[model samples]
Target: MGSSARLRLYMNDNGPLILDGGLATELEAQGAKLQGDPLWSARLLHTNPQAIRDAHHRFLLSGADVITTATYQASITGFIDHLDVSCERARELLMSGVHLAKETAETFVCDARPAGQRCPLVAGSVGPYGAFLHNGSEYTGAYAQEMSIEEFKVWHRPQIDCLAAAGADLLAFETIPSIKEAEALIELLREFPNSQAWLSFSCKDGTCISDGSSFSEAVQMANRCTQLVAVGVNCCSPALVEPLLQSARSLLSPDMSWVVYPNSGEDWDSEQGWLTSEKTSASISELGHTWMKQGAALIGGCCRIGPAHIAELRRELKGSCTSPSSAV
Candidate 1:
C-alpha cells in the first residue's frame, strides 16, 4: 500500500499517530558527537550507522507510530563537498539512512515489541535548502528571497528522488521556512506519483510561517496537492502550535491531516545552543492536548524533545483516545 493509504488505515484504527522526536537529540544523548559537523546527525550515516539505528530503536520502543530517517541534513552536493565522495557514494549514504530506519523498525517488530504493537513507518527526512547551507537560514527563511522557484526545484529534486527510490514510506519535507519551497516540493511530488509526503513548516509565530507568509496561505497551498497527506508545522515553538493548528484547520481540507512537532519550549542560538526559558509555561504534554483540540491529526516533538517526551505524549494521547490499544 502507499504511504497515504497506510496512514489513513492507521488513523482509522488509532486516534492520532505519534511521530518520533528528534533523532539528533537522541543520538547526542547516546554520546554521538555532532557539533562542528555540517551534516549533523546525517554524519552518523557514514561514521556510526549503528548509532542512528539505535536512536530509531529508542523512539520505536517509546511508542512512536512513525520514525523518520537521519537524512535531514543530507544531500548529494553536501555529501560530495564534505566527504569528497562521488555522486554514487553520496546516494548510497543517503539511501543508508532509510535502510537503517527500516531495518530498525523490522527488528523492533520481530524481536523487541510486545504483541499487537504495529511496526512504525519510516519517513525519509528532507530538510530545507537552508539546512544544506549549514546556516541558521532554516529558522529565518531569509534564503528563499534570493533563490528562485526553479533553483529551489533543482536543489531539492535529487534529494527527493534519492529518498523516493530508497523505498521510504513517505517523504518528510520538514522544517520548511517558505511558501516557495513548499510550492517547489508540491511540484516535485508529481515526479513520484506513487509517493506521499508531509510538508511541515518552521513558523515565526502562530499565524505566520518562517518567511512571514500566513499559516493559512501555506496550509492552503499544501491542501491543493493530492500527494501531501498531511501539512502543518515543525521545529517551531510549542506555544505557537495551538494558533498554528487553528490557522491550518481553517484552510486544510478534511482529506488532509495536520501535523505539529515543535521544540521543547526552548530557544535555539547558533552559538549558545538551546537556551531554556523560565518564562515558558506549557509542558509538552499540555501542548499535545491543545494541538489535538485544535484538530491536529499527527503530533510529536522536535529539537530538545527526546524519547522520554515521546513516551509521555504516547501515554497522554493513548489515555485520552477511546481506543488506546488501537494506537499500537
Candidate 2:
C-alpha cells in the first residue's frame, strides 16, 4: 500500500500514532552544541549524521510511530550561505538528512520490531521560511511581510524537491507561523501531486497562528487541501493545544486528522537556547491523552522534550513501548 493508505490501515489497528520528540533536544542530550548555529539540527546532517540516526533510533525505541528527518532547518539558500556549499552540494546535504532518518527507521524495524506490525514512517522535516532567517521570526512570522506567496513558494520549492526525491514517506510543513505561508504550502502541494504531507502552525495562543491570522480560517482552508493528511499546532506551549483544537473542532473535516507536538513549556531566546528557569511542564504523558481526545491521532513533543518524555508517553498509552533487548 501507499504511505497514506498504510496510514489509514495503521490507525485502524493501532489506535493513535506516537510521533518522535524534538531532534535538537535529543541532539543536545547526546552532546551537540547547537546554540547560535543557524543550521541547528540540520548541521548534524552534514557533520554528524550518525548522531541524527541515533536520535531517531531512540525515539523509535521510545514508541514513536513516525520519526521526522534532521532537515527541519535545512534549505538550499541557508545551506549555501552557511555551509559554504554550491546549490548542488546543498541539495546533497538535504538528501542526506532524509537518507539518515530512513536508514534508521528501516534498520530499527528490521532488527527490533515485531514481524506483523507496521514499521515507523520517515517524515521529511520542512520548517517555515523564517527558520532559515536564524531568528525568532518563525514564532512571529514577521518575515512574511518581505515575501509574497509566490516568493515564498520559490524559496521553499528546492527543499521540497530534494526531500521528496530522497524517498521520505511524508512531508512535515511544521511550525508554520502564518496562514499565508500555509496557503502557499497548500498550493505548492498541488505541484507535487503524488506526495503526502501535514501542515502544522506555530501559534501565539490558542486562537491565533503567530501572524495573528484566524486559526479557524486556517483549519477551514486546510480542510480543503486533499494532499494534507493532518493539520494542527507544533512548537507552541502545551497549555495552548486544548483550546486550539477546541476552537477548530466544529469546522474540521472528518477526513483530516490532527497532529500536534508542542514544546516542553519552556521559553526560547534567539541569542540563548531554552531558558533554564522553566520548570518541567511537559506533562506530555498526561496531556497526550487529552490531545488524543481532541482528535490528535499523531502526538509528540518539540523543544526541550526528549526521549524519556516520549517513552513515558508510550508506557502510559501502550503498556509497553519498546523491546527490552533491542539495541539501536
Candidate 3:
C-alpha cells in the first residue's frame, strides 16, 4: 500500500496505533552489546541481523502496529568514517534495516493471525544528525548552530533515498531537535514526492522543542509540508507528552494526526548510565491512555522502554490489561 493510504487507514481507526519501543534497548535485552558503537543499534545490521529481526518480531507479538527500523543512528558518512566501508556497502547496510523489519512483519502476520490487527507497517527511522555525533547533542539540539539547511539536506538525502528505494511504508523523521532540521527534512521530502513521513521532535519542555522553538511553530511548519502525515514529539520525557500534544493540537490541521513516543523518564548522563526520574515513575502503559486522551493518534516508548513495556501498552490499549507473555 502507499504511505498515505496506510497512514489514513490507521488514523481512521477507533484508537491510536501502537508503535514499537526502543530498538536499541530491546537489542541490549537480547544480549547485543552496543556500548561504544557510534552506530548504536544500526551496527547490529552488520554484525547480528537476526537479532534485529528478533527484536522486530517481539514487538509485533507485543501488538505494535508499526515497527521502526534500526537505521536511526545509521548514516552514510558515519559508516565511511567509523566502519571504513565503501559508500556502496554503507547503502547496503541501510537497505538491510528496511528488509529485516519488513521480513519480520510479514512472517509475524502469516503466523500469528492476531484478532483486530491490521498488517503492521515499517517506518524507516531517520534520526537527528546529532545522533550520528554520539555526543548526547540529539537530546539538546545544540548542533543546529553549526549546521545549515543545505548541509542538513545534503546529509539526510542519501539516507532518505536509500530508505525510500528499499520500499519502507513510511519515513520516520524522529527525534528532530530544531525547526531548521525539520524544515530541511521537509524540503528534502520534496525530492521524493511520493514519499510520506512523520516529523517528531525532542522537546526540552512541555511547550518548547529541544532547540527552544515553540511546539506551535514546529507544528505550523509541519502543517505546510504535504508529505508529512503526522507531527509530534519523541525521545523526550513522558511527563511532557500531554502538554506537547495539546500544543500540537492547537496548531495542527484537523486532518493531521499526532504521534508520541517518550522515554522512560530517565536522565542519561554521557559519563554515567541512565538515572531514574520521579516524573517518569508511572508505568508506560499508564501514560499511554493519557497521551491518547491528549489527541495522540500513535503512541509508543523510546529510551529505556523495552518489549515488556510495549506489551503492557498493547494490552492496555486493547482493553485487555492482563499479563503479557513472559517472552516479552
Candidate 4:
C-alpha cells in the first residue's frame, strides 16, 4: 500500500490516529508570554494565533496525523474563568480557534503533504465546564435556575453550532468528568449536522472519573452517540489508562476505535500550589506504543506533552508497524 492507503486507514479504521495536544497552555509554559491579555489566564485567547498554528505545524512534523484546534479554553467556561468575559464573546473565540486551525492547516500542511492532499483535518476540542463541584469533582448535576441546563444550552449551543459549521472533521470532547456532562455533550453534538463526535473521560485512576463513575460506564454511555466515530481517555496520567483499556475492550465494537491521550503525570499541587511536571518524550513514546498494544488504536499526547513527544511517538510507531507507507 502507498501513502493514500495508510492515510485512508488512519482516517477510517480503529488504528492509531495520532493527535497533538496542549498548545496554548504548553506554549505559555514554554515562555511565550502574553502580558496584559485579559484572556491570559485562558491560554487560548492569551496565546497568539500564529503561535497556536505553529504548534499545530510542529505536531504534524512530529508525525501527528491529527492536530486539534486550540479551542478548549476559548469556550465560555474558560473565558469567564480567565478574563471574566461574557459567554457570547468566549463562544466567538472558540469558533475563531476552529477557523484559525483551518486556515493554518491550509497554509502549512497542504503544501507539505506527499502529493494530492489539501490539508490536515482539524479536530475541534471542547473541554468540560470549568467549575468544580463542591466535592472537588467536575461533573455537576441538575443546573440551578441561575445556571441551569437550559442556560448552558443557550451558552454552549453557539460554540457547538459554530464548530460544526466551520467544517471540523471531528468533535473531540476532552476531560469530561461527569456522566451528565458527557450525555449533555452528546446531545449537543447530535444537533450539529454532519459532525462526528468522540467523548473522553478524565480518570485519575484507571477505573473511574474524578467524580467516581467507572470507566466502563463512561464508555458504555459514550457508545450511544449516533454520530460517534470513536471514544477514549485523555488528561490523566499515562500509567493509569492502560488497565482501563483492558476492562473496556470487550464492550467496544471492533469498528469503533479507542484513543488514549495522557498527560505527563503532572498535576496541581495541593499544599505547595504549583504545577507538577513529569512528562518526557521517551516515556510518552514508550507509553504510547504500550497504549497501542493495550487496545488504544488512537495514540497521542495531552497536557505537558508537545510536538517533541508527538514526533517521538511517530518515530516509534514507524519502527514498530509493518506498513511501509508509515515511513516519514
Q: Which candidate should be chosen as best, given lDDT against the real structure?
A: 3
Candidate 3 minimal-lDDT segment of 10 residues: 319-328
- Model 3, 90: alpha-carbon shift in Å? 0.7
The lDDT values for all models are: 0.86, 0.87, 0.87, 0.65
| Candidate 4 TM-score to native | 0.79
* Candidate 4 per-residue C-alpha lDDT over 1-328 given as tens digits, one digit per residue, 9 for 90 to 100: 4322334456664446767766755566556763344343235444456677666666666566677877654555656676677877766777777787778767654455533222566788776664322222333223322354555556557667767766677778877776667777877776775677777877757677766778888888877775776788887777777778877878876556787888777764534433656552236678776777866667787767877777677667654321224322
For candidate 1, write residues 1-328 as lDDT tens digits. 6666876788677567889999999999999988668999998888899999888888887788899999999999999999999999999999988889999888877776444556788999999999998888898889898988889999999998888898899999999999998899899899899998899999998799999999999988898998888998998888888888876576778878888898888888788888988878476777777777777778898988888888889788875321224334
Models 1 onward score TM values of 0.95, 0.95, 0.95, 0.79
Tell me the spans in candidate 1 whose CA falls farther than 4 Å from its real position. Answer: 2-4, 320-328
Displacement of residue 304 (Cα, Å) in model 2 is 1.0
Model 4 CA lDDT for position 246: 76
What local lDDT score does residue 207 receive in model 3, on the 0 to 100 scale?
94
Clashing pairs in 2: none
Q: After superposition, how far is residue 184 of candidate 3 from its true place, in Å?
A: 0.2
lDDT of 3: 0.87
Determine the backbone clash count of candidate 3. 0
Error of 3 at 44 (Å): 0.7
After superposing candidate 3, which stretches have Cα over 4 Å from the reference? 278-280, 320-328
